[model samples]
Target: METVDEVDAPQVRQCPECGATVSVHARFVSWCAACDWNVDPGAPDPDRGRLAAYRKRLARRYGQQLAEEIERSGQEARRVGPDGSTVLAFGVSLLVHSVSGGLLLAAGLLIIGGWHTRILPVFGIVLLIAVATLLPRPGRLPKGAPVLYRADAPRLFELIDEVGAAVGTTGVHAVALDTAHNAWVSTYGIRNRRVMCLGAGLWEVLSPQERVALLGHELGHFANGDVRSSFVMHGALRTLARWYYFLVPHPLDSLLDLCVNTLVFLPRWAVYGLIVLLDGLTLRASQRAEYLADAGAARAGSTVAAVTLMDRLLIGDAVEAHLRRASMTAPEASGGSRGREAREAAERELWERLAARIGSVPESEYERLRRVSARRGHSVDDTHPPTHLRRRCLASAGPHPARVVCDASRTRSIAAELAPARARLARTVIRYNAD
Candidate 1:
């Protein structure tokens, strides 16, 4: 009654126990509908020696490159004659203003001269409106954002401070925890206040030592002066793009809108090009900053820990995918609390599945992950380099044990502290979605 199916093709297989047909789609594993007998062909055994050698070569080659980048970052940091991206962003902003001003001036002269007076003023107004709309406002976090603050999680705050001090940068103004599976540090408020954001989902999966490495990498941005420059450059470029697109005249608008759109079309097009140019000029520096952060992680934790952190971070993607898939299923007759309980259960399940899979990732699969990451190195607009490069760089730096270590009890306490905030944040999310 047993039958075999080809890999990656939908084929019918007969159950050995009950002789019922079951459709199998995947390659690595298959199952039966009517019987529980294993129909798995199992994954092939990987050559551990070859994988070890291959990774060793990658570490040796890319590690040298990482060392060069570290030197470059240090040299550039010292030489500071206005950051290249800042200069480019400013220059582009000035160019946009100049072009807009020039057009308005010409329109004013035309109005004063009584040549095409009506048309000129209308065109001038459109350009002015475009300029006004495009000016960059200070960035702000979303309204009713779900965040766990310092007062709520003092232990986590202490952990952050301890990690920051060890990494030689302890100027944190605030710390917030969210549901995301990524950690970052950014500036908030008009006064350029620095804040650290840690992901609760990420915390759930990582060991205490790995958390230290994550904190180190994020805090390292401040130490390397990446925060302010990135905020300025990214903000400026985004504003420019906004302004450029705002100038596009819609057909539904009156004829004047079309005419105005025509007048500024070339300049708007030029703005797009300038954004592309700025991206190219700044990409290498951005990638180097990522390497420096990886080095920071290695310095704060062990090289093994840093690399493991990178691998574990990849698992977050899978967790998100599973969550999305689970959301597609029809809900049972569940009320509010029941729905919330169900969601929490799903999250717990996803974390367990992700952790188990990551914990036992084979060498061959790890190699495959590295290749995929390397192939998709930083895109033109990406702020970080490929995961493989980061992993390689951390491996190259060699291992350094963490300066601060925490026990399982400490980690659990932090999670417990976040419980109330997590509930509040969940309510905020539900309210937002309802609205």
Candidate 2:
């Protein structure tokens, strides 16, 4: 038996049954030249078949489990684990539950009272600030920036247009390959309403079928309001943080700071315990939201493709996460960073030399910079969680909540259903604020 990655050419050996030359590479077993003895190739074929079946069975089971976990959590804001234990994120912040009407009323009264008393202009200024906060945040992409949907190849502009149409949400304004192995849409432009291809690395590794699932996953975000909810949360966070900062006056800032430092700098064990409690609770709802997004993808495209993409995303995510974690310890990635550029250059050279040795990369004088990229990314404290953690959110998933009977017509049907909603929302949002 030979591996696809390792084997070079057909192996020739004397037949065990007779002193005759026999050639074997894949499952095929040719007739021995001397003895003319033919062997059944079905043996290897069945074993391969069995292995394929087993892999598929396991993949589906894992997918189902992960899906179940997500659906359970998404609907209830609880992390329902294998043992049936339910944990939660820190108690829902007042932001999640605050009634807009109440907040507006309070804001209105504050403004009027300030004017009535002829007080400082702070209250009216605050109300105006609050209104501004309500606007949706957009992703960060310039207009029609070229996106390398995948390394070595770019998804056509028309395909992106088609996908945006299917989602019936904001169309992709710019495509950028994310450094991570997974794919996502980042809000770009004004208030982050524009979508950016957040998965350049992912597109690099995934097959076309798997990429469709990845696309569908983004579509899930569109369908499930994940994007909208994220912006809403951002506004809420901004609003609360503003209030907290506002309340901490110059006089009290010192005392408040002291208390925060003391609590945070407590015994290592104590701090860790507190963080775990908060994190565990927060993960519950966050995990659940992930499932709804998964379900959204399944409903949007072929389920089989979705599953396939997830599997690739899982395995590849491991490598990406390793690089990401390493980045945390890695020196800062800048021209000033010591040896960072040199180290990356060295790695790139090694891979390129190997690729050239294997004919994987084209030959050119400038081929050295051909597809130049650092496998390691900067560890910026961004909204996205760690790569491995994000991967588990999908890789360890269970069955899709709704089974998709994928067919030629399925794409059109899904697109049609989403188009009207996307158009209406686009128009309304264009008129209204993004958030």
Candidate 3:
């Protein structure tokens, strides 16, 4: 007796463009094996705004350039130092910081001399308020996200520490769990303590090894000396953005207001120009850092695991679509109920449904996504290299054995430790979707 799988198996067909054999799956995209015809049927349109379009072009250009350089020079592309562009980025950053400092100094001088001239104090106070508003502060974890310390998640921390050691960085000081479909490492507090934010959506879908690869990639940012992530450079960029926000013209109500806006126009635009220049200068280096981090992912998890991780990232849109669909249908599914009971039911089913959705994705779909990525020059964002380029770089670097393994025992233990955070994130996701 033929089972459903055998009866519904994919049929092989000849490609119209290249006369190559292709498998036509019932529920997945089919493209030419040789010519990539129909690989990206819905080709991405140009980004909406001129600046956004420019950024996309710049990312694609630099991504390809870095890939070519890596191919030509092999290991030389991984070396980190203050290259001319980096030096200039830092110089521009320092100039912005100096302007902030000069304003602070002027405010201090005016306040100190206020006893001799009363009006000086009011102006000093105003300048102080401006400085306060513009001062750059370290990022904070999301207010309602589940924050975990070492005591709370010992096993999870152990896994992260192992990955971090493999990547040659001090491990994260804390972990925060959220409902996002992304994960990132960020610094918080005056001491610059590292915090790794694990998105439950992404975390729940990944295998144990892929989780390690994710950690390796993020920790690699710290190990690889990415200048853009550093305190001084990041703070300077933030300060400049703040300055531009305040200096930019507003709606004019009177002749005096128009005059003031006109007076500040040059300085406002100048600040904007500096922000663009600094961003452009450091962007290439940041993209290089991302490739290096992908290497770190391969090192910590085996090359196969790292490659699969990238494939998983390619399916993020699919995952998001699934989530959206699930969220939208939750009300309909729950006997048309609303509020706490319905949300609780959705929360209970969210992770399981996501896992099933991701697992059900056919092999052909992954292949189609890979081809589409190559055709579209797909990227995570402007800051990172294209996904296809990163995957290719990992493949070219040869197979790497896992330096930090996440065996069944450790995996189970880590899951046990993360149970609370998982539940918290699930509730958050359900509530957010309901709203």
Best by TM-score: 3
lDDT of 2 by residue, 1-435 (tens): 644334534567777778766665432335454544553222221223432343333333433454455445553112233222221221223333254446566667777766667553467667657755643355456333334332222234344444444544444554553344555666655655545464434554544445555665675556545421455544444444444334332333687777655554544334334333333333333434455555445434444555545444424423444344433433333544445565454433332232222232112111211111011111111222222333334444444432323344544543343333333322221222122
Which TM-score value belongs to model 1? Answer: 0.67
| Predicted structure with the largest lDDT when compared to the true one | 3
Candidate 2's C-alpha runs over 4 A off are 1-139, 142-155, 164-170, 189-193, 227-230, 238-289, 296-301, 316-318, 321-435
Q: All predictions: root-mean-square deviation over Cα?
A: 10.6, 16.9, 3.6
Cα displacement (angstroms), candidate 2, residue 384, comes to 11
Model 2 lowest lDDT segment of ten: 370-379
What TM-score does candidate 3 reach? 0.87
Tens digit per residue, CA lDDT, model 1, 1-435: 433322244666776677878655553234453453453233422424532333334433444465566455442112134466656655765665565566566656655654465776666566656555555455454345455567777898888788778777884667676767787778778887777776655765777788888888888787765522565466556666676566555675788877887888887777666666665555455556666677667667656678888877655655555445444542443558877677565544544554554454444344444444554341111345556656765665545877778678888898688666655544332322221
lDDT of 2 at 231: 52
Question: Which scores better on lDDT, 1 or 3?
Answer: 3
How do the residues 1-435 of candidate 3 rate in per-residue lDDT, one tens digit apiece? 964456557899999988999988765678875788888888584666654566677778888999888877654248567789999898888888888888998999999978489999889989989997777787786688889999998888888888989989879889998877788888888787889898877888898899989999999888897888887799887888788878868788899889989999999889878877887898888888888898899899888888898888888777787777765665533334455567676777788788876876778788889888887777877567889988888877778899999999999998888877777776555534323
Off by over 4 Å in 3: 1-30, 43-52, 74-77, 112-120, 248-261, 331-345, 432-435
Range of the 10 consecutive residues with the lowest summed lDDT in candidate 3: 331-340
